[model samples]
Target: MIGWRLSGALVASGVLLALWWLWGANARLSDDLAAERAARLAAERSAVLARRVAEDEARAQLQGERLNVELKRAAIGRSDPVPDYLLDHLRGLGVVQ
Candidate 1:
């Protein structure tokens, strides 16, 4: 009877330890998955932000080119006799002063 009780206790302790170890492993797996998801989201957001910044930079460059063209046209027009079209454009820009 004593031997039987001792064997039962040992078996119970082994099962309990195994269950604890499995639970710890499950917890670790859950944490790793969560971390991976967060990293993926951060990367996706960063990619989107980078794309938006590039688009903004392109728009700004186009605007700068447009302004430079307008300035050159105005400068050339001013050096010559003003035509109706150039006078109208200067009026539109409120540069009559």
Candidate 2:
């Protein structure tokens, strides 16, 4: 009878110890997961910011190209001859006949 009681107590203590260890491990794993999630969010934000900057730079480049085209047109003066396509269209309408 005494042996039975002693064995029961030993089994209960082992079960309690196992539960405590499992709880600690779970808490540690949760902390690590939270840290990883935070790092990912930060990285994503940086990537988004980089993309916005790239888009802005591309828009600026397009604007510069348009300015250069306008400058070239101005340098050529407004005395340029009319396009042949325009003359054909006007002749078709009898305006240039």
lDDT of each: 0.82, 0.80
List ranges where model 2 is wrong by over 4 Å. 71-97
- Per-residue lDDT for 1-97 in model 2, tens only? 9999999999999999999999999999999999999999999999999999999989977876664465456447744555668657755855444
Worst 10 residues of 1 by lDDT: 78-87
Q: Report the error of model 1 at residue 38, Å.
A: 1.8
* The candidate that achieves the highest TM-score relative to the unseen native structure: 1
lDDT of 1 by residue, 4-91 (tens): 9999999999999999999999999999999999999999999999999999989977876765566667667844445668657856
TM-score of each: 0.71, 0.60
Q: lDDT score, residue 76, model 2?
A: 76
For candidate 2, what is the lDDT? 0.80
